[model samples]
Target: MIQVRGIHKSFGEQHVLRGIDVDFHEGQCNLIIGLSGSGKTVLLKSVLGLHSVDQGTISFDGRVLGDMGKKEVKVLRQEMGMVFQGSALFNSLTIAENVRLPLDFFGDMTEAEKDERVRFCLERVRIDPESFSKTPAELSGGMQKRVAIARAIVLNPKYLFCDEPNSGLDPETAIVIDQLIHEITHEFGMTTVINTHDMNSVLEIGDHVILMEKGVKAWEGTMEEVMDSDDSAVVEYVFRSNLFKKLRAALKKA
Candidate 1:
């Protein structure tokens, strides 16, 4: 489990995260959902250690992140896998090479060992070995995202971070990716954190939802609770629902 307590961050004089507190559970999709500039991205970066917090504490299973030495931090990072918004694959490298990149950097495995691990990770994500020789330009967007997932899990990370996993895919494709991530995450029992603005993802996969507004944690609940909550801002945010809009219109006409 990941525990975050009183995490405060600032960019010079502009405070972005205001004493944020939340816990991300393992084997579930912990989602951070909020409007743009609500400090969701800042929170994600702070948790990942990409951006340091001015105050508060973040810990992985009770090990405080703020006090970790450089070597300890490096070890902690090795257990982490991140899927970026853009997929972040190299256009020049083949699919196999891209998946093998992390292992190359951190794993002391031989060339043959790396190749075997690369192929295994790709197959696990349902990417065929034939695509191993193909570059990013040769595959579709969905395929590219799967390749990114393969690379991420190739490290067998204990924690996974996804930033806007469904940003560019079509709705149908987005659902597919969402289910895929949810399944693999639970199977490995990995601690996963996803930053999303997609309500569909929120309703479908979110075991824990953290809603932020103006740098504050406005709400936190499970998917079912989120769907049925009485919070005005949450209701207004999800008021874009077709059924709700239709009900309002019919009531007004009556």
Candidate 2:
């Protein structure tokens, strides 16, 4: 599990996250959702350690991240994996090579061991084995996302982080991607954190949901609770549309 307590972050004169507290459980897809400037992205970065927090603490299991020494921080980073909004694959490298990059840089595995690991990860994400040698440019957007996920898990990380995992895919493809990530989180029992504005993803895979507004945590709960919530920020941001209202009604009827 990952725990955040009294998190406060600032950028020069602006305070972006204020007294945010939440817990992300393992074997679950935890979602951070909010409007564009609601501090969701900044909160995700703070949890990822890409941006340092100005106050409070973040802990993975029982280890406090803020107190980690240089060597300890490096070790903690090895246990974490990230999938970016853009898929961040190397255009020059083959798909297999891209997945193997982490192992090449961080693993003690021999060549054969790395090859086997890469192959397993790719297959796990449903990428065709025949496409191993293809560059990122050759595949569709969804396929690139699958490759990114394969690479993120190649190192067998204990925690996985995804930012806008369904950014540019068609709705059908986006659902596939969301399900893939959810399955991996449960199958590997990894603590997964996802930052997204995709409401479909929220309803489909949000095991734990945190709603943010204006640098504060406005609400936190499971999807079922989210639907029943009366919080203004959550209602306005997540269910303001008639389409979403109809979807909610459909879900409730089911």
Candidate 3:
């Protein structure tokens, strides 16, 4: 589990995250959802150690991240994996090489061992070995995202972070990616944190949901609780879509 307490962040004169407290559990997809400038990104960055927090503590299981020494921090980072919004694959590198990059940089494994690990990770993401030599440009966006996932888990990380995992894909493809990530989280028992505003994803895979507004945590709960919630701001934020509005109307009439 990942525990965050009293997280505060500031950029120049703007206070982005204010006393945010939340817990992200293993074997579950913990979602951070909000509009632009809601501090969701800042909160995610803080948890990932990409941004220095002004206050509060973040812990992985029982270990406090703020107190870790340089070597310990490096070890902790090695245990964490990230899937960026853009998929972040090198256009020049082969799919296999991209997946093997982390192992190349971090693993002490021999060449044969690295090859085996890379193949296993790619297969786990459903990317065929036949496509191993292909470049990212040759694959569709969904395929690229799969490659990114393969790379992220190549090291068998204990925690996974995904920023806007469904950014540009069609709805069906997005859900496929969502389910893929959800399955992997439970299958690996990894603590997964996804920063997104996709309402469909929130309803589909949000095991734990945190709603942010103006730099504070406006609400936190499970997917069911979020849909059932009557918090005005939350209701407005969530039911903004026509689909949800229709669902709400039907629920009321029922």
Candidate 4:
């Protein structure tokens, strides 16, 4: 589990995060949702130790991030996996090579061991062996995203971070990716934190949801609680979707 307590961050005159406190549980998809410039991204980065918080504590399990030394921080980072919004794969590298990159950088494994691990990760993401040699440009957006996921998990990380993992994909494909992330989180018992504005993903796999607004945590709850929430920020954000609005109305009638 990851815990944040009274975390505050500012960029010169622009304050991005204000006294944010939340817990991302292990073996669950903990989602951060907010509008543009709402501090969700900053909060995610802060948790990942990419940005320093001026006043607060972030703890992974029982270890506080601020108290860790350089070597300790490096070890902590090695245990994390990140999937970017754009499925940031190197176009010049083949799928297998991309998945093997992390292993090359961090693993002490022999060549054969690395090859076996790469193959296992790609297969886990449902990528065929025949396509392993293809570059990112040769695959569709969905396939590229799968390759990114395969790379993220190549090290068998303890924490998985995804920034809009479903971005740019069609709704069906997005749902598939969402389910895939959800399954992997539970399957590996990893602490998964996702920064996304996709409402469908919120309703589908938000085991724990934190709603941010104007640099503060406005609300937090589970998926079912979100459906029933009357908090102004939660209601406003969720009902913005016609589908959710209609679903809420149907539930009211039922």
lDDT on C-alpha atoms for all candidate structures: 0.90, 0.93, 0.92, 0.94
- Minimum summed lDDT over a 10-residue window in model 3 is located at 245-254
Error of 1 at 164 (Å): 0.3
Top candidate (TM-score): 4
Q: What is the TM-score of each candidate against the true structure?
A: 0.93, 0.96, 0.96, 0.97
Candidate 1 lDDT by residue in tens digits, 110-229: 999998999988988889888999998999888898899999899899899999988999999899888988998999999999999998898789989999988989989998777667
Candidate 2, residues 8-114, lDDT tens digits: the string is: 99999999999998999999999999999999989999999999999999999989999999998898888898999999999999999999999999989999999
Error of 1 at 210 (Å): 0.8
Q: Estimate the Cα RMSD of every predicted model relative to the unseen true structure.
A: 3.1, 1.3, 1.2, 1.0
After superposing candidate 1, which stretches have Cα over 4 Å from the reference? 243-254
Pairs in steric clash, model 4: none
Model 2 poorest ten-residue lDDT run? 226-235
| Model 4 regions more than 4 Å off | none
